[model samples]
Target: MARSQAQDVIRCQYCEDEPAVFHCVPCGDELCPRCKVFHLKSKVPSGHNIVRLSEKLHPTNQVKMCVVHSYKAYEACCEDCQVPVCIACIQEVHGKHTIGKLKDLYERQKAESEHELTKMKGQYKSEIIQRIKYFKNGEREIKTSHKNIREKMKKQAQDFIDHISAILTEALDESTRDEREKLMEISQYRAEAEIFEQNLEQLIEKFETLTESSHPADLILYRKQNPDTFKRFKFPFKINLTLPSYTIGHINKTQNEHQFGKFIRGHISHLTLWDDSLQAKYLTGFERVKPSTKKVSGRSLKISETKTQKGELYHVSCRDDRSAFVSGQGPGIQLIDRSGTELDKISTDWEPAGLAVMKDGSLIYSDYDNKIIYKVSLKKQKKIFINTDYGPTGLCCTKSGDILVCMHEILFSVVKYNSSGRKIQEFETDQNGRRLFHGPWSVCENINDDICLSDFSIFNRVVVLTKSGNFRFTYDGNVLKQKLKDRFNPRSLATDSLGHILIADNVNNAIHLISQDGDFLSYILTEDDGISLPHGISVDTNDNLWMVEENACVKVYQYLS
Candidate 1:
């Protein structure tokens, strides 16, 4: 590198020389500072931005080039070789190499790069817009799905407020009664005080009049004391009623007129759905799950699907499905047509919860809440025996007519009672240490004597146990995939004659269908007429469904098949 006091370092327009002069008036040659030509004619362009060879041009962003010669002006890149090339080297090296014009090459490439950057920026903008749309739409759908739940929660809160108000109202009434008693006592004392004050005032007024009298004859006559007039001056003690504090409603465990407690006229316990011979007749069983204990879910439930409503059913040394005893709510086991229409009502003091008519025609039932398993004779009444876990809610007569029960409360427990309600053997609760939540809501003994209980309250789980309380499988309305997590609360359980377990999905407001394994089947009612606050559910031998809503009517949905 070299420097000079003149412009054009590479060449001089007038002179062809190397180092003496940066430019020359005569044959000027672009020169470095060391190569300045002495006594050179000056032809400097005043407005030119070119730097002298003796000075650095402050590291110019404009590429270095010859100042006066337009042909030698700065250019960013060479197009033909696709590399940086200067004007002096062009003719020497790139003159015959298909060299592109420099200015044209730089302009063309700069525009192309700019276009690419614009295209990429547009693509990013479109992607951001699409992503926002995706998320917002998904959020709306999820919120809509729980629309009813929000309303339900608000209603529940209001109902809770009302319940608290009712408690306060009761307390306010009690306070009023107490205040009235005290007010009555004060009223009597105040009346006596008023009488004493009136006598003293009268005596003081008489002394004042006597002191002002001039003579005895001039003295005013004493007025008569009238007790009736004084009595009218009394006023009773009265005060505003006191307000009472609010109370939250809690479970009232005490016995009251609401028909709660053990005296029980009709309380639902073990309920089950069974399919008998006909599709028209399905069975729902109810059993006295516990004899001495007073709790629901202990009663066993079983119903026999009869073929025809043609005869009053009894253990007619029963042939096939012809004469089967049924567990029912109505007093007296009413003999019914296979359709459950009453043919003749048979009276029995025992409100049987679980009922099974044996092959040789011995009728078996769990007495009034899975308390005592019994053998009933339509011709005679008798208590066969006692057996079960806290009480049995489901009962099924085996091909051998031995009773299998799905127990309540304790986990993985189900007992089998012989025809005489005697505990032939006990199946202890020894499963995978998985005990049922709360007591069992309901239970079912499938034809195989495998037990299943609709268990779990806070944990809303349903479990199937073996005959000996071994955990075979379980479902808690939750799964890795969302599809299986919908139906969580099961109220009652039953197996159709086809061996499908029908579950009363109470919280889901539908019936859940499941295989004996943990596979979830479709729901029973998904549309409008399916269910509302479904509480207890059972299937008749005909595959018809009978369900109870909180305080709503017991609806019977008949499956035409």
Candidate 2:
């Protein structure tokens, strides 16, 4: 048995011809003396803990030697230094330090390491797996977002190309039509000239024959037969036809981008893991209030009328079921009830240009004289909301608590501000860089997040824009045709529950109801309906139309269910 065991000796892993004397723990390589030297000289890291093969095989019985005193075996562990120490090291270097038996310290450390391993295996490993899944989901979401963006961009490009092609085709067709008409006129003139020339040639040949043949009797006979032809020949008048000419429109890179639309870099959010709790919180859905499908009757039934002392009221904002805030060319804005009773009054140093009721039941008004916007709390306390560079004419509060202010005068723009008064966006021009508004009189937000405003300038149109500040369309009351008695003078617009824009045409003494897309739906109130000079308009929560006339007479009507 002893001879058989000796014959079963392991060979060197590096050199199979010789027996391995040492084992490298980190590299897991068994080597002979010569191979060991070569392995140490190779790219192996320093302090590999190479030990004798016998000690490696029986590691539990192996004695540890002190690092400082290599000749002596470790007997105690110095707690202060956190290292194993030999008898000589304890007496010399660790004389005043806390020490424990090496065997006891090893047992305690082994138990602690096992506990830590168990904890990691149970908790840390599961957490790492969950984190991996979260990151994978996030990667997929990012890929999907990028793909959608690419598709949207491609669609926009194709639409723009199609639009340009259509325009070009129309222009060519028009030019061809003009060319055909002019060519037909020229052909008619040529045909008339050819007939006249033939007649002249015939007459000349006859006269030449008569003169050359010395036949006075024949010439006299021919002249007597065609006496009417002897008169002066009549020539067709020249047609002064002008050819068509075209002037190419100059479109630079900036103008082209404006017309075709350019990319707008949106806000990018930070990346975070969507855990179960986060998913439960964010993935939940809520009910949305759908817009009404009822059509406008074009005839509103007058419900009640409240006459206010404020002369020529310019604005009226419904507060709730009972009261509304009204402002005019007065020193203060008054909140009045259905019975014409004053509920409250907010006195201002200057006349308020625009007034709106916020979601929190507070009143906000714009002072054009001071170029400032003030917010009045329910308790009648006033505070400065925002300072503007231009006079603010109209203002409204959105469902999200953001304020939309119409700044008029030299700069015509609608500026959006958050509750904290931070400017979020501004719409000054259309996609073609043309001015969007001449004088923005009143502003309102639709249920679809579209902005509707009345322009009180000579244009007298209602402009609509998307939430992202993109131009949608404009309504100029041309669709009304003969129905519109006077020029469309839009002022003080409001949106109904059906997302329809109702604009007051004070000059025509009518209210024009249009869709969110700027399509003229109907004239809800007209001169025939006894709505005289309707100016300030608003829609209450109950879908009731509240309008203030030029005489400061507030009228409520049931226009929609």
Candidate 3:
């Protein structure tokens, strides 16, 4: 285009005549409408950004300045360092690093940053907020519980004081009556002495009269009337006014005893609501599933078997590699090593059925014949821990050292007792007031402290109860689909460190593994695994499952792997 140039008029640089319409960024030239089109179409400055002259003073698409080099704008992004760099930084600090165009890099980085921020706000931050709310509610509940306990204790203290006061009043009334009786007795004796002195004076006067010949006949008659009285001088025995001793009673603070008029310390347990590994798996969106090993599997667990001379292994409890106790129709509970060698035999009063080991290396076993559970210490000292009306079938020592026993015959219930043999709680019926288990053969506590019972009756299932004795759920072998002919009779139960409940399915001759919350996981061992009619099951600290089979043998299976 041909145009005339005027310096004072601020005309288009290309036309050199008309006023500027737009500013060309790359060419740095003000152009009219025709010249702006020519500038956009020009091959030499093809990438120039054109802006309207009105918007030239305020550009919205201005590039950010480099923080390191204040005067320079970022031209490229270092892929290695993931940072934008100016021309000066590219050659100095980010030299030799793979570079990407600054615009493209900005778009990519913004998307990634936004993605992470959204996840933080939606999942992580939201979870934290929810946890905070839970903690707040728990705090309020704890405070209310403490207050209630305090009020109850106060009432009990007042009742105790009232009882003592009544006793004191009753004793004082009896003591006062004794003192009044003694005073009465003294007054009666004084009056009798006065009468006796008058009588003596009368007799003396009569004698003097007799001497004066006034009443010889009267004196003789008085002596004749007093003959019976002179036979015995009647006198009240010395009043022994001894009252029963009274002392002010006070509540004695005995050790480990329920103390009155005192506050018991309250505590809040630590909360571990969610697993971090599970959370990570959920966020990454990529599930790395393990190889399927469910049907017709091989040696997933290393198995070892041992047969005892007792010929019948009904129950087994493993504390450590050195101390795994087994019981049956044996003379005593046998403490066996991992190699199946009997380390010691604890003599029993009756045939042993259920066995459990305490945290202090002591053994607690149940005698089915006598309906007694005995606690045998490492020092050979034994004491009867509990005696149930029904036969005790299975028993387990909880993490808190409480013993949970499963009663078999009439009362099919799970009873919990402290280490000192005091019954803490009992779970007979479920939450809806229905019977929980039909002939609970075995019982175990999961990692979350929930009680699991193995039932062998018609409704063969594993019944679970919460730590507080509330029913949680029941597993009825529905999760593990087996043949109809093979019943779902669970003989014994055990739980690993991971909270997976392992039950010995007797009819199926397998070990059924279920999640802590009663979700069926998978079968650990099947009939193909050579486990025939598995009975008692126990898991050691190393997560090794020890099982007693009806074939008169004990099998050890390493399950943690």
Candidate 4:
């Protein structure tokens, strides 16, 4: 019976020659005593736990083996070295180190790993799913937005086509009416000529019959009855007709693109999550956050002056090249350099009532006499920009290249035109139906897109309105009455980068500065500063104030650093 039981025992998996005595937990190998010693001496990592085959525990409860002592199970862990150690290893190598039970360390690490996995599933995975849903919704919104835009585009195109069709119909109808009236007059004249021809033929037949009659008596009677009729007959005057002519307008591709609008693409970046709470713990060596600040001007300073020969400068517009376009009561607009040298000139039949320099270095001006706004290109090509019922006085170019024109006649109002010369908006009255201005002289746009104008009316106020034409506030120089000691007579208006409104007070001989909200700030330029009869003012990109005096002098000042 002993021999039979021994024969039934499991053989070693390594050598396959002797009955198994030990089992390596990590390797899951059954080995005899000799094979176990040989396996421990093999060139594998040292932490293979070997136990008696009969005493081997479940895989989950297996004892950890020390890396240095392959034959011994770990009894403790060296906290300082962060490794499991056997009792011999602790006594020999880690005797002075802080120690912890191997079982406790194993359980702690296992629990921490399980907790992290649970949190990942509960929070991180859910957050990722939410982000996916958000992207899906965004995609749907984009599709819907594109559909709406396409529909709008189609509708606008149809409207344009319809407008052109109406014009065509009107032109055809006018031409037909003119042709019908002219033909009727020609037909009436032809009928009168036919009658005259019939009468002349009847007279000639009567004369022939009398000559053939050989009766002198008959001829004499006829002559006596028609004595005055035989003298001479005059023909009707000739009718001259002129046909109507049509001139096709040239289409500008750039202006059409602006009118049609365009798509603005947004930038997309890779998504990243940052935990502020963990930043200090993980990014301790990183730089700390700092507050942002803006630089401000200390005081206003007179920079330079450019004398012009234009005579009574009415408007001044600064250019990016440090030059300026100055217009006056003279017959032309002059472009002058900072040193008062004439760079160029655009001659006009009459003085330009309003002047503005476009972003493309072109010039735009309003002709009060012609009731037209003209644009002069950089190539010196001049063309009509817009025709208005009222005379346009003061004009300015908005940041978006739109023109803000102030017109006054029976009604005082400001009109806004796009770069394509299409009228987009008009500001005439407030929400309460009250007239916003009696005479809007000079117009400008603030940095915040607010419309600021100097009203040369009985009120003598500076009107500030929102971009949508809503009433914001009005500054009538009441706050500065004590200092000015004169009636407010604002002529031209301008706005700086800081959104301060600079008004040329003609009566006070000063340029009053006010906040965008209509609060009086200060007199940035006055008689003491040599600002006399200031008519037009503008702010350049460098925050320099450019002013035009009635004496045709263009002065520049630095009010911001």
lDDT of 4 by residue, 1-561 (tens): 999997899999988889998988767789999999988876654357777888576433366666887777776688888788877898899999999866677777789989978877876667667667746745655666577668878987898799989999999999899889988988999999899889889878988999996599998988888787746666666777676687889999999886676655533444444443222111101122232232234556878887776679889888763888889886798888777888888889888998888878789999998899999999999999999879999998998899999998998999999887888779999878999989999999887678999889999898888666768789988474667858999998887766678899987898888876688877777787777889988887777888889988888888765
> Which RMSD values do the candidates have, in order?
27.8, 22.4, 9.0, 16.6
What ranking of all candidate models by TM-score puts the best one first? 3, 4, 2, 1
lDDT of each: 0.51, 0.80, 0.73, 0.80
Model 1 spans with C-alpha error above 4 angstroms: 1-340, 346-363, 368-370, 378-380, 387-390, 406-412, 431-438, 447-449, 456-458, 478-487, 530-561
Per-model TM-score versus the true fold: 0.36, 0.49, 0.69, 0.52
For residue 308, model 3's alpha carbon misses the true position, in angstroms, by 1.7
lDDT of 4 at 555: 87
Give Cα distance to truth, residue 479, candidate 2, Å. Answer: 2.1
Ranked candidates, highest lDDT first: 4, 2, 3, 1
Clashes of 4: 0
Clash totals for all candidate models: 68, 0, 0, 0
Across residues 349-451, which tens digit of lDDT does each residue of candidate 3 receive? 6777788888898888888888898888889899877877778878888878888888877667888888778775678885478887778888887765678
Model 3 collision count: 0
Mark the 10 consecutive residues where model 4 has the least summed lDDT. 278-287
Clashing pairs in 3: none
The TM-score obtained by model 1 is 0.36
Model 2: lDDT of residue 185: 80
- lDDT of model 1 at position 458: 66
